[model samples]
Target: MLETIGINPAELAASETLLKLLISTALLITVVVVVRALSARYIRRNVASMELRRRWLVHSRNGLLLFMLLGLIIIWGEELRTLALSVVAIAVAFVVATKELILCVTGSILKAGAGSFNIGDRIQVKDFRGDVIDQSLLATTILEVGPGKLTHQRTGRMIVIPNALFVAEPVINESYTHDYVLHVFTIPFKRTANWQAAQQALLASANEHCASYLAEAKRYLKRLNEYRGLDAPSVEPRITLQMPSAEEVHLVVRIPVLTDRRSSIEQSILSEVFSQQEFSGAKEKALEQEGSAPTG
Candidate 1:
């Protein structure tokens, strides 16, 4: 057609090459759209896990991008060798420059694949502890939990953490297979106080408050051992002593509770321990002794 208009041979070749490139790109785009639509429809119909389905869709999109790049190289090979080489060089540099972003996306893929943690799973990475509430390509959002507050209550803050941190930090899946958490807290007393009695009182309180947890834990652990042969330790209520100083003794109570009910469970335990006659009687005795002493 160009020859009929008296165009030169070199210009004609360039035009033909450009036309081929356009056709290749158009075909690649069409294939991408059709494949995604079909895959999405199939996944939505057949796949059960929402996370797994989303991951499959994401993988398909990434595969399409790679296919488009490869198709471009094949379409423009011989005559456009210099252009392709330049494009490859630029792509390599871009990938290197955006390494963190690539890592985050890669981390998201790995997270989905490994079933590391899911929405509502209680997890701790580094100093951040919370329940995962949202996940995206770049970051994960968590309903923040405590250190500054008692009862393991949420700080009423949402934390947005980069997904790439999953690779960089140790991920602690606290409530992975089970929907329960080990709520551990310490009740301190003076060294002269009846610390052994306090320990007993706390243990009794935990056992009372964790009635359902203890039952569920027994069933959960039995299944785990029977199926996976996990040589797991006892999940029964326990009280361990920690002496921060010679003057201070802490009775640490460790017991299981539903993950979302951490604060309430802690409150219940605390209330029970404090309400115990031994605790209040000890406090009144201490006050009386202090009062009877010289005012020097």
Candidate 2:
């Protein structure tokens, strides 16, 4: 029949093989599309966190890939096993020669498994600090902050660091245990100013901003002490007067607010302190007293 149609038998076999490959590719693509759509509709949307959604998507994708690999084995013939093993061996050798790359991949796996940090967690590794915007098999991306910008505010740059950094570098996950960070700042006033009044004003302002988180902060400290036997640090708004010199007195205020809003919250408290009528009124009264008193 092939001779009559002027088609060679070898050519016909090759064509058949190509057709099978194409069909298998198309089938795999279709399966992926359908699965992704279903997962996005029913699985991803209901997930509470971005990191959880990403995990679900990755699991679905890997499952689809495994299914496709099995399907390809049947489509490509049994003999492809030798070719697959050869390819795998070559890949292993290549990865072995590139030690750093393998370490990065291993780090990614370990970091994800350990759950030390996740996407959307603010972390500092070495000198780089940012929110983890992406974590992949080889790298983790950070939305850059600090070093010429506000410590907690985004600098509008992305820093992609090799995941291998996680293997060796100490990582500070600010939001790992809690969303609020202890924000501390100091304001100095002239010694003659009403430092007591200013300290009261600072406490009031900080408490107004941080009262909501006080309960949880206290509870966390309690549990922390129970678990680790570490002394529980004060988590409430507190003011300490620091006198570096007789001429200058500083009021140090420590308050807890959402980590991302540390700078803004600090600014708010300071603004409130300076704007406090009682604080300002005290200063005015002091000035009047000085003006009326006999000159030294």
The lDDT for every candidate, in the order shown, is 0.77, 0.77
Supply the TM-score for candidate 1: 0.69
User: Model 1 segments beyond 4 Å from truth?
Assistant: 6-84, 109-114, 147-151, 225-228, 276-296
* Total colliding residue pairs, candidate 2: 0
Give the per-residue lDDT of model 2 (tens digit) for 76-156: 765577576769978788878998988897887778788888667888888888887666677888888766433457789
> Candidate 2 deviates by what RMSD?
6.3
> Which of the numbered candidates is closest to the native, going by highest lDDT?
1
Q: Each model's TM-score?
A: 0.69, 0.63
Which tens-of-lDDT digit does each residue in 1-296 have in candidate 1?
76788988898788888897888779887987898789889988999987577666666666776787788777767757776666987888989999999999888877878788876677888888887777777788888888643436778889998889887787888776556656677788887777777787778878888876688876776676667767765788899988999888888878877766777888877777667556535756878999999996
- Top TM-score prediction, candidate number: 1
Residue pairs with backbone overlap in model 1:
none
lDDT of 2 at 242: 93
